[model samples]
Target chain A: MSRVLMKGNEAMALAAIKGGCDAFFGYPITPQNEIPEYLSEHMAKEDRVFVQAESEVAAINMVYGAGGAGARVLTSSSSPGIALKQEGISYLAGSEVPCVIINVMRGGPGLGGIQPSQADYNQITRGGGNGDYHLLSYAPENLQEAVDLIKQSFDKADAYRNPVMIAVDGLLGQMMEPVDLERTPDSKQRERKEWATDGDAGRRGKANTIVSLHLDPNKLEEHNLALKEKYDRMVENEQRYERLETEDAELVFIAYGSTARIARSAVESLREEGYKVGMIRPITLWPFPENAFKKLPDTVHTLLTLEMSLGQMHQDVKIVNQGRYHLDLYARTGGVVPEPEEFIEKAKAILKKEDAA
Target chain B: MNSDTVYRPKQGLTDREFHYCPGCTHGIIHKLVGEVLTEQGLIGEAIGVASVGCSVLNYVYFDCDMQQAAHGRAPAVATGIKRVRENHAVFTYQGDGDLASIGLAEAVHAAHRGENITVIFVNNAIYGMTGGQMAPTTLIGQKTTTSPFGREKEGTGEPLRVSELLATVPGAAYLERVSVHDPKHVRKAKKALEKAFDTQMKGKGFSLVEFISTCPVNWGIQPRESLDWAVENMIPYYPLGVFKDPEKEEEDD
Candidate 1:
């Protein structure tokens, strides 16, 4: 497949089509509007479903409707918009509906700036929606990876019978990069959803009801435990990360999405200056790629975690670290994208402080 | 057991008993919908969206593909289903609290988009499922748990006329306000439901049938008295009539 230059949001949109997405329901939000805009025309041309919903809340519920009706569905929004979608997301999770949601990260506590930020690390990985549920969340650094993951996510969602989220920063959504949009099938085989409520057509013996309400306490407990088992399977089988030169290194850097690209640059410059630094890029945020920490050589003593927010991902790192390695955090919150040199300076200062201690 | 059966239960409903309170009009309304779908031979081809009010558990009773939606979100969910399954019949069962109060945007926008679906709006003038709280469709002088001092039009505003409000939306192809106070009116309400479903089947656009229902327990009245109360108090404020009919307009023209 030839690589074509495309915007990050648009590529993900086209990738959804190539991934056998039968419907798209979304509301327009900054840095992610192109996804809906592109799909509105293309989905029509492809004879698929496309609805520009009234709000993010309605869009996600529409996703619940489409997915429950046995259509491969997708929805996209930014930070505050994603916040609005939490109610429907909880419903989708409780109902065990399959769908994909893309959150183009932006600054927020409430209506914060539209600039790129990883402030939603907790919102995506943590249960933003009320429930004991987790989304199979991925954070990709570049257009190609975003397209591939977004495409595969449909099948992953269907396979797990759960929602999958792709978390990309506003910079990635607005940036242009060359991407190969060819459909690459994942090995996970998706089965036919017999639980879908797509009208009987006289074939079904009974009506299929898509629901989340369990009135009985013991029944609700059973449903929660069933969901927990599915999440545990995701943890065991779906941990993914890219290890860059961790062997025989003194320091390791942890980052993901757009910040991971900057961290890679910082690591390369530091190695040239004889700092013996490596990096670990986590592709799966929910699974947290704790296995990456186990791969670090005994020589690696300090691990630095970087983000565009105030140490949200740092919480996960600390939980997984268990004080095995000295942990340090460097964050530039409120939509500030730090430069590679800044990481270099931060890393040097951290190493100097560690050496002094 | 098979030969002399003169009257059979509606096939569109399941054997599962409804959880609605005695004399609640939800059961009567459910029977109307079931009869309409079964009579139209759409039970196999219909999908019902149950809302988060008294009708939340209608998914169990409605013998068709069903999805339970969050509070005030059944319209949005129904839109998603209809958009995906265009050839199939899709409808939402919502109460006044679900449709008028919280889900106002979802309901209005679904109509504004002219989504090919049906809405069964039940206006009982009070919230029944939440122990008789004041609803958006509550009568001006009616008292409830939330409006203990009788609903004052100054602070809470008057009751919402959902059928009239939706009639103003250009996308709505059919809008009717019907009451189920008596046997004669129950027949008319069922006819309204049939027409609403017919509008969807004909691929017209958004259609809604708003039913003036009785909540005996919530209203602090006897079951039969609640019907009379609805006729006397509710019907005067929410006058029954056809609010919009695009196809009827065409015929008149």
Candidate 2:
């Protein structure tokens, strides 16, 4: 098949379908409207189910139900819309119904702006909804990686019976990239899903129940512990990141999603000037790449976290770094996109200040 | 030499005793749903979405694949399940607080989308599970814990006529409002549920049967008196009978 140019929003929509998604339920929201619009146009042509729900709240509930019933489902929105889905996302996580959700994020804390920002990094990685739950979250820096991760997330979701979120900035969703739109579902792990609510007709005379409410405190505790165990396993196996030229670097730039791209540029320019700087880009934000903190050269004495938010992922870096190195944040918040020049200047000053002290 | 067993508990209902208060019509409504599922042979293929409130435990009583949704979100949940398994009999059981108040958008939107599913709404006029707050269906002048001085038409406005509102949606294939206070109305309710299920089986569209019910404990009255109070108060505000039926309408055209 020939590669075709596609927008990030539409690419993720097509990716889910290629990964065996049976239904799409979502509402209209900015920087990601093309996702629902594309599905609304093509789902019927493909004979796939599509519903433009009344609100993000209803859309996520539809996703929860559809996912509970053993169908591969998908939903997409931006920051404000994603906030509306928090309550239902908690339910989906609690019920352990596998589905895929995409947050092509915009500036936020509340109605911040409809522009590219990493403000939702904390919200997506930290469970924004109530309760002790963690969804496998991926932050891809480019359109290709976004499509690739989302395409693979559906099966991974089923393998664990959990929801997987793809968090990107508005820029990725709006930009166009060339990709092969080949629809192929994973044949491995095609075993029958016995846990799905596919009717009691085939099961041996017993009803299936999908619920999140554990009324008795003891039972609820048990459920919570079980979820914790699942998250622990995810941490052990799913942590992912990309490290570049950090062996002899003095300061490492830590970032993810859109900011990671800018950080990469900053590192490249610093390297040309013969300054000791490198980059570490986290692909999976939750199940965060703690392994990146395992071994470090003596020359690496500082960790610089660059983000579009006001220092969210810096917390994660500090938690893992555990004071082994001096940690700090260089961020642009509320819809401000940072240029590589500011990072080059900040990194030189922060490192020069360390030397002077 | 054995005689044919003509009558027995249908496989659609479990043996567990209901948690509903004594004299509440929830048990009656559950039985009617169970009976209809069995009669139509849809029991094995049924998936019920249990709402919050007293019926939060409805999953345990319905002998089919069941899901318990967050308060007022069962219709949306049922919509999800039905979209995935179109041939399966999917239905949602919701109370006034769960259906009319917080979940009004979910309910109305599901109907507007013409989602092929069944809804069994229990309109008891007050929130029974939360200890008698005035619900959307609570009578205009009715007294409840939240409406101690009785509801004021000038303040909270009139009680919501949920069944009538849903009937106006073109996607709704069938709509009915019935009560379980008397034997005649009980029989009528059973038929309404059966018809709603049939509408889903034929892939017609959305169908809902709202049961005007009672809550003795929350209403501050004896169980028997609550039934009389419902007949005297709720019946007139939310009248009984079908508001929309797709087959009949198509015939008229």
Candidate 3:
């Protein structure tokens, strides 16, 4: 492993290469374009394929194809581009292809602006595309976490036989941080071509059909039910969350991605100001850290949900709180990231109100 | 004769039976593709991207790695797959509406970039999956659900001739349009498929074969009569011939 300072987007591309990715397919999009630009220059040198597909739709489809062939493949885009990829992502999920998708989220509902925002929480955590499926969504708050999560994303995608998304905000994608570049385990050292479309030369007797369509309504339903079962298994096995000083705290700050980064700063500042404020940051947004919130002590009086989008993830926080605690929502959208000082002020206010009550 | 001795259809298809209507050319086309994969020993290395439309369930019939693509996005997906696993043969099976309508950008760009992939375009004139809607390839004065008053050239514009249009694109290496209404035409289409596959194997860029097929059920005609309709009405509008053959052109050059 070698230490290097790298931007989140550049680190993700390098991580994909280190993870033995055979292809990188993408179109130009804000905040994440650095990823594709880096791969376009380096992938061919590594004997990997690189394509600047005409559109995000094409780039994602390319990922679907390469993934079906059992190659570690990836595609990255910002909000608008990711919207175009929803259909392709849905197909990959339905077909049970293992691939990594990186979304350096920007503000959106439509061409929202090229700034860091966790506005895509609903689209990422809930199914972004059509049909019943869940992406293993990893939210990285900083550049180092971005590289680490991307490397782990490939393993999780293959392990679950589903698409894994490294959902970082534009802040993380654009920021530079110190990271130790670790080489991924060689592909030869791992399980070789057991479930891929690598020409059935020696293993199977005949060609294996990989398809998501079972025209019969009954069979399709069964396939979907099986997918639900797999999702349940993922929820049970892959839930990850972090607690910062939540042990005897009166108020908990619930956030993720960049918002969690701001919340962490606020937690530190409030602790210095002598307030019992802590933070719960979710690393996996899909298999959300519901149990972590549930484990909070009864003395935890208020839970403040901070996000870049208006009240998207607050619903999840409320659901986990289960009416046991009062829920407060604070959000800034349209590419505006909440300042750490602002979050600290809000935390102080909530604690003061709690004391008065 | 015993049931086993009788002339039975190909065993490559699933026993589940297709939902395609009787006399539909999709079943025949599927059989041809299956037979080609089986014959060429390409089944293991072949991955098919099924397009949106009547043939969405194509994954069920083809005994290879099959992926269902959004309307017209098959070519893009095939490009991605072929680029990554260059050793694998990738192809897209798309219909008229899916290819010429919403997925036009993907189809055109894939051909323009000379991506080493095969596209099997099925031009059935009308949208069969969505209850006979007017398609980008709907013939002049052809009446359907969306074009109840008939497809007017002035308002709806002329039907797109994809093979002719694609042949002019510099990136396309081989472009052919064949009809499957007759046995001879079917054989020609299969040969075209073989050539397309061969071109990819040889690292030749973008090869496309457009099949003029009959959607008898959606045409509101008897399945047998639909073949005659395709021959008389559809063939003249969309002619049948190889527009460009790179190997032959190279020989001449």
Candidate 4:
């Protein structure tokens, strides 16, 4: 495993390659352009499939086809582009196709700036596409964790027969960090997908068909329930997060992705000043790691959610906190990232407001 | 069961009833596809990508492996399926609205890339599923739900001649437009399907065959009249001929 400094987008592209991804189809979008550029250069040399699709809509549709045909495929886009991909993403979810998708999120409700933002938290984690479906969502806090999660996401997609989304802030994509390019897991090489359309050569008389259109209401509900059961299994088996200094701490911080990384520096300073501060950094945002919130020590009295969005993930935090602790939100938006000192000020202000009330 | 099968339905087509509206010619095209695949010995390996519109559930009808693509995205889906499983014969069955409208770019690009696949595009002149509406290939002056006052040339543009449009792409190896109105034309349509699949098997490049189809229910005409309408209206406007066939050209050379 060679250690090399790499941008998060390039690291993600290499991580997918090492993880045995068969194809990469995507369009060039800001903050994630490096992913397609890197894949284009290496994938062509490696003789793998790399297509810069005509549009995000086309790219995701290509992903749906490759994924349906039982090939490991990946696509990446920024927030606005990801919005364009939602319809295809929904189709993939509806068809139960396994694939990996990345959204190096930039600021957006519409045509927002091309900078790091957590604004897409709701969009990615909630399955931006139509229908009742969910993506195996991961929000890694650093470049290393992003690489690890991206490599594992392909396996998760294949295992669960669903799309997996790695929603990282644009900063993590542009930031350089040392990564081990050889960390590909050989054990996770998938078997032949029986449900995939990989040709019926020597298989059986009936061809494997992948379709999502359940015209009858009864059958549609049955399909939705089956999908819900699969998601429930993920909730039990796949929830992951990191907890820091929760033991005997009165104030706890809940954050993820880039915000969680920034929260670490703020938590350190608060602890050095003799304050009982802790952190809960969620790795899996869809499952929300509610168990981690449930396992918090009794010393935690107030929970503060720090995010780069307009407090989108804060809603999930509220759901998990369940009124046991005072929940508050400290957020920035439209590509503005909060500094460590700024977070400290916000945390102090929250705790101070609680003290007065 | 037949000990020595002679007249059993083609193994390429499944036993499921087609969901096409009564008098629609999608069933004929589907049967032609099945016959062609069986004759080419590609029944077991052909992967069909079904587009949205009326034929969305073609995944259930084709005995081969099938995928249902989103509206207008079947060409892109077929490209994906073909790239990953190169040995399999991949084809897309799409309707006029699905092909000439929202999915135009995918069709053009796939043909340009010379993707080894077959496209059985059925131009029935109107959207059948969502009720009769103005399709991109809808004839000017055709009245529908969207164009209740009749589709005017100043507003909706001319009926798209899709076969002619795709023939211009450099990577397309074979392109043809046929009709399925009568027994004679039905036989010819099946032959065109065989040639299209054969083109893919030869690793020739992109191949497409547009069928001048009929939509009786949506066209406000009887099944018999729809056949006459195709001959009188669609055939004249859309025409019926080989727009481009490199294999035929090479033979002439």
Top model by TM-score, which number? 1
Q: Each model's DockQ? A: 0.83, 0.75, 0.55, 0.71
Ranking by lDDT: 1, 2, 4, 3
Instruction: Residues A194-241, candidate 1: write the lDDT tens digits.
Output: 999998645788789999999999999999999999999999999999
- Give the CAPRI class of candidate 1: high
- TM-scores, chain B, all models: 0.95, 0.96, 0.94, 0.95
TM-score for chain A, prediction 2: 0.96
Q: Which portions of model 3 miss their true places by more than 4 Å?
A: A183-189, A201-203, B1-19
True contacts kept of 4: 0.72
Worst-scoring 10-residue span by lDDT in model 2 chain A: A182-191
> Which tens-of-lDDT digit does each residue in B118-164 have in candidate 3?
89899999999999999999999999999998999998999999999
i-RMSD values for every candidate model: 1.0, 1.3, 2.4, 1.2
- lDDT values, one for every candidate: 0.92, 0.89, 0.85, 0.88
In the range B73-131, model 4's lDDT, one tens digit per residue, is 99999989888889889999999999999999999989998999999999989999999
Q: What are the C-alpha RMSDs, in order, of all predicted structures?
A: 2.1, 2.2, 3.1, 2.5
- Listed for each candidate, the true contacts retained, as a fraction, are 0.86, 0.80, 0.67, 0.72
Better of 1 and 2 by lDDT: 1
